[model samples]
Target: MTNAPFVVMKAVAKRWNGQLGVEDISLDIDEGSFVALLGPSGCGKSTSLRLLAGLEIPDEGQILIDGRDVTTSAASDRNLSMVFQSYALFPHLSVAENVIFGLKVRRVPRAERAKKMKRALQITGLEGLEHRKPGELSGGQRQRVALARAIVAGQRLCLMDEPLSNLDAKLRNSVRKDIKKLQRDLGITVIYVTHDQTEAMSMADKVVLMKDGRIQQVGTPDDLYNRPANTFVAEFVGAPPMALIQSSVLGGFDASLTLGLRAEHVSIVSKGEGQLSCTVSEAEFLGSETLIGLSHEGTVGLSVLQPGLALLDEGTTVDIAFDAANLHKFNQEGDRMSEV
Candidate 1:
């Protein structure tokens, strides 16, 4: 028989008073894999992480970690470490002190704590800055201190709640790579919560996208990008998102259906030479390319990517073309249709 999942949340749910927090959540995670709980604010991603970390007991269903049912276990009883978005470091404590505080509280011997602290500091690249207090360090350095603390605990599973959110864009990118590398080197399972799709798409082996206290989809980055489960996912997963057009606007398809396609699949052709004619709504220039937003009578998120800098004027008429095979069809309820 095959081995069981390293972690499982079986129909787990939570609520406050009469309102829903998270409902009917079920998932399986493999060992040493990075899984990201991703969604917008109030989408229950953090609540789900709290439930898995034993910070919030589930109102329904069971949670299993390493084959043990910990649905009702206390947070202390679960062998997992947590890093929060706020860093949660004591300003008065030096980096070394903060890193080993958990071990000290657990009554680990002084010598052993020192050994663990040393390795944690080395791994997180904070060896020279160990004597500095949290207030004395940069935002990124303080966050690393929190990571060092988690490392020193020697837990096989770690939960991080938007640990990079406080950092600036550049620092977020830097620490994002650091956290992914740290998780890989330690061979630990990580359950991270984030509102940013970029972090989830870049760092996670699997992504569980939630909305309104429920899961929308769970799959690899590629699966969520190329084969979204529904319209919400199709519109939310990409940078520019997939452009959707009513099937009535196109021929050879059911009028009740919606058609989805990406900007990369759309090309600009000479006037009157393409499938659909649209008006330019806006043009945005990135470093390497420009995106031209298009407006048609029955389409949303319609756009085409132009190489270099091609700034089409607003209200300029353009013709865009795409292969029929690239179209993704959806039903009235927004669910994807199977390939025909």
Candidate 2:
């Protein structure tokens, strides 16, 4: 391979009858790195993945794979593999047949195909189930079969379109680790599409958070969590999300500014002895800690974490304090400000 990046999308844009699919999308994927395209539904993550996969041609810009321009090439010529959200296996085919179908199509020798199938099955823990059809396998097993198929060809680049969406929570967790381990063990590059922040944060080397057909942020999980580029990113990247308070709610700040806060940075103080007074809206016990949601006149998603079973009553007034240094300041347009 050349010294260039493994995959590159330079200002790629896709539209359907002048309706935007994804616009001005540009990204660089390093060899063997896991990059996640993460966003809400209809936010262009899948569209971007499709553009990269050559399933949809871009109206503008170019796509390069390992220094070769493949913008107008057929999907079959991309030299890549894909794992879909729907485990696209033939119902009549046994596990071994399904995994080696591509090899068969390429007219690989019988011995070589069998060796590849055996290795893929071993990597995916499907050795004993080789004779079973898709109808007889569990959802997780079917997904593993799809993964095995994707990797059986030894493609260096793999695109996954929310491959774990069909599995239940526990199965999703198990298969998530399995996929990451598979990618790492084989030294393959992966571009994964997902709307789940947990999956992106846990599995990806980099996250591309998108919204409304645009990339909101591109950074590491910690960078997005700690130094979000703007309010949209600040709110979208976390579970409970960052709380936004009107700057006027606090002293010495412009009314047009918004201040962002995290639950970990907020502390409950004695009544009337803190920065702001809030009403307890609800308390959710999460076994080890209680997530205490609070409401103030000018705050959105205000909450604090209280240690272990500290259930507070609704409408109870509590004082909350936060350090100035821990606050994130934003302009009226919601872009992050360096400091107050």
Candidate 3:
């Protein structure tokens, strides 16, 4: 609506020693949107961030910040702040010093810097811990310091590369919510990069799924999960991912396709048309839910999620059903296809 993101990348590409780092790609990230670059390691997601941050110059094409060419601009001139996965705080500095490090480097007035430092600490829930060193705080607390440092810099755009990777599962989940809330309250444009699909789905307003140096798809989380553009997305997203039947059993039919259904969508419904018979192979209890692995006619394997505990034995036969509307069809080349 309003001139989307004030950032743009046009025909961007990067290569190193004849190996592609990122292929020609263009994107428009509107202001105040939390856009996540989601992909596996070595998938060019990080490379895209470097280019945007001016940490790496593009091999070709240009970058525009609010319609101004900044392709050749120095990293310092980019007016952006970044938080790395490592929580790269100066080891000897206390939390307060770390948060104001950027301001000091830019020679911001002492009084202004102090005011912003207090604000950053309060915003990140680090006010009382400002004097503590990174070594003295928990991993979650350390990451919050890094976030405060980025915000204190007063950059309109913030780039984060796996900021929660250092925490354990419980801490990761807790910090993820905190970060999302912070982004909302600040209303700052953020480009977050991570390989964890859960993080992307939970936080991003727009998710950019990447693979092998190219963008696979860019859409809202619901768009990617319910309407993947290809098999790769279906297999990569969702917890436990979508259960895929490698080849359809409808003999002589278009067996050159794979069927995609999320674990929660594939259920043991009452017998119905298009139902695929499967035998239970294993069941796992995950406290809030149960994961049941199934195989159809002893060949096609799949997994499903059911609320509460599963009561079936390993060999019990069950009809695994899915709503055709929730199904995604992919061709052998991994491209998605719409049913006729």
Candidate 4:
């Protein structure tokens, strides 16, 4: 990482017709750092990436790369690379040709283009498949081809818009690891856009979460998970999602307050031996752990994670407890009140 910022977005805003695409978005990307723009569909994450790519011009604010203003510059003039979800490769071109297309367009000598092509293919594990066309490759392999295209450019910044959206679960995980390793090895800055929290949390050094064209919070994965800025972040950044309860139901808390607890933090104990009592409403076997859903007094519903096949049947009563130290408090406005 570098001390000076490599990319800066100052209050950038984009609108389509009468509607806003992204509003007042600002960010500073450190050199060699991987940042993720995360949010649901239509939440402006992709739009933000396009803005940085110069595919969409911002109606307000400015974008600077390496301290150079490129707000209104062409995408090619920005000296950045982009990998799309569609793996936009020339169907008729061989893998090697596709990877070296940028160098060819830039009129690099044949020897220089070949050197870059070879290096890109080797880095992406596509050395043996260099002769194959996009049609002959698997989904993961094609994605690698697209990555090779980006890496061959040797740019300081790379913008990825849901690059793994087309891969299956198993392939997605494998390629995710490969991409992270490649980024570290190359020491290039990346801004990836994704709706999947798992991908964002696992890969990014920093996450910029968005909602309705505006930023909700920006933080590390642990920071977003442990200390969400508001209820929206608390509910969006988790896997099974955090369970929110009315504070009044837990005793000695005001009715206007809410409590947030993670499934892993809630432990099941014998009846009368825990802080709260509930009846099991549903149980799911998730290979290494059991997800037990509990309904309390026909009002509050919560999920708890129990290790390795603790099969409690539906309708069975179990007490649940969590340390006060793990509790998160929120006021009526949905903003974080305190970390208990």
Candidate 5:
């Protein structure tokens, strides 16, 4: 509960077989904040999580927890809990037994273990499932057990690595809320690693985006979406992902470079000054809204967000418009330029 960062990685680097895994990553995670490490597969998000957990040692730099150096400390000495993608529960052990396995290994008395187990089960909404083994529980239930175990570990930090990946879409959405609520209620500092941008944006207090084993951007969800630091971040955080088009293809000047805009930021407008004209390539009505795709003469496509049933037939010529205030510009190297 101090102003000092609860977890710190100073100039961290990791290499494997002459390949760079992660390079010069320095981060500060505050106490009680939920931070997500987001990246595509093999982008070093999971590796970074393991380094912070003390399960893998960094080749360079230091790892500090609560102002104490734990760079080379044993994973047990770090006093942290980890919830994996797999529940990793024992097949024969009951939920209650699995939840308190760590405490049992540490020689905690049965009376105290029972108290801790009860509290953990209550927090995770699995109070009556204690008697059931992993084989007897549903996917969601098993995941909850994993979360409950982390809670009962009574650690200062919790590291969750794609804990929701195995669940179905519906189950993932529900359990995501449950986990976020649980974390907020407990006021614990958590580091979450996930390849799902939706999960990252919806749950994390701060989102740390990585690419090619390097840090890209770190900000709140809204900040990451509304003001992406670079083209990689702008393209990575959105649902169908942000659209990046060459400005020249859209009839803008040669100085225009690359234009970045979210799907919803685009629209169909009257053919006039400042409008980019194209032909309707395709359209998909998704309940309350419609997605209209436009393709220019040279095959440059732009996505337009239109309201319900405002459908346009394919091959219809249309003028594409976007809010000038919302457009982001990027150079050839993908560095962010001022909004044009």
Candidate 6:
């Protein structure tokens, strides 16, 4: 892998009907790295992907691939492959045909196309189903066909836009692992777009989180989870999300500040032994851990992820405490305050 970034977006901005699709966006993607563009709908993740693919030209920025400006390049000229949410496979074509479609269009020799098709099929685990049509295959298989097509293109960069959104939960998990493994095996640079944080955290080396047309944070999954740059990142990055409580509830912090704590970080302690007290509002049994939802003096709702089945009934009072070192403090503007 190269030491320099394989893809670069400098001051990229896109506008649609006087509204910003993505504003002042700049990102560097290292060669052979997996980067996820993550956020909810309309947050510009898809827009950014399109810009990189040359489907959408930026209003004010330069896009360079391998140190050459491709801002005005055509999608085909960019030499990148894209896999979309819909699978985008031709219903009339067989899996093998679909996988080799790009090579055929480029007038590659039949022998070369056949070799690449077989290699892509084997890598994507679609080896035996080459003769099947998209309509005859399961959702996961069809997705693999799409992936095989991208792989057969032999591009150094691959772009994915919510490619697993159509799969069932079980299939999504299976295919997610396959995609990550395939990227690693191929050593291709990948820019994946997804609203699912779990996918971003589990697959990508770096996560670029976006909100309302701008980047909210860019870092490793651990960095976003353990040291969020602000309240939005703190709330959005975690599962069960982070519980934020007003500083007044704890007494010693600034009144205008909020304290953030992960559900896993807060433990239930004996009454009077903890820093704060709460009444159990709900208890959810999730096999490996029990999620105890609590209401603290009508001010904030907090969740405690206690290991195993430690069922605390509703209305039962419990004391909860977290390590002071693990607390995340955010000021009135929702920006994180530096550690004291």
* 261-307: candidate 4 lDDT, tens digit per residue: 88999998777899988888899999899999888752344789989
lDDT of 1 by residue, 1-340 (tens): 9889999999999999979999999999999999999998999999999999888998899999999999999999989999999999988989999999899899999999999999998998898997898988999999999999999999999999999999999999999999999999999999999999999999999999999999999999999999999999999999899999999898889988999999999999998889999999999999699999999999999999999999999999999999999999999999999985
- Would you list the rank order by lDDT, best first? 1, 2, 6, 4, 5, 3
Residue 31 C-alpha lDDT in model 3: 89
lDDT of 3 at 103: 89
Report the C-alpha lDDT of model 2 over 1-340, residue by residue, as the tens digit. 6567899999988889899899999998899999999999999999988887889899999999988999999899999999999999999999999999999999999999999899999999999999999999999999999999998888999999999999999999999999999999999999999999999999999999999999999999998999989999999988689999999889699889999999989999998789999999999999999999999998999999988999999999999998988889889999998743
Residue 18, model 1, lDDT? 75
- Output the lDDT of residue 320, model 5: 70
Q: How does candidate 1 score on lDDT?
A: 0.94
Clashing pairs in 1: none
Candidate 4 clashing pairs?
none
TM-score, cand. 6:
0.97
lDDT of 3 by residue, 174-216 (tens): 9999889988999899999999999999999999999999999
Q: Where in model 5 is the C-alpha error above 4 Å? A: 250-256, 271-274, 297-301, 338-340
What is the Cα root-mean-square deviation between model 5 and the actual structure?
Answer: 2.1
What C-alpha lDDT does candidate 4 achieve relative to the native structure?
A: 0.91
Model 2 TM-score relative to the real fold:
0.98
lDDT of 2 at 274: 90
What is the lDDT for 132 in model 6? 90
lDDT of each: 0.94, 0.94, 0.87, 0.91, 0.88, 0.92
Ten-residue stretch with the least lDDT total in model 2: 331-340
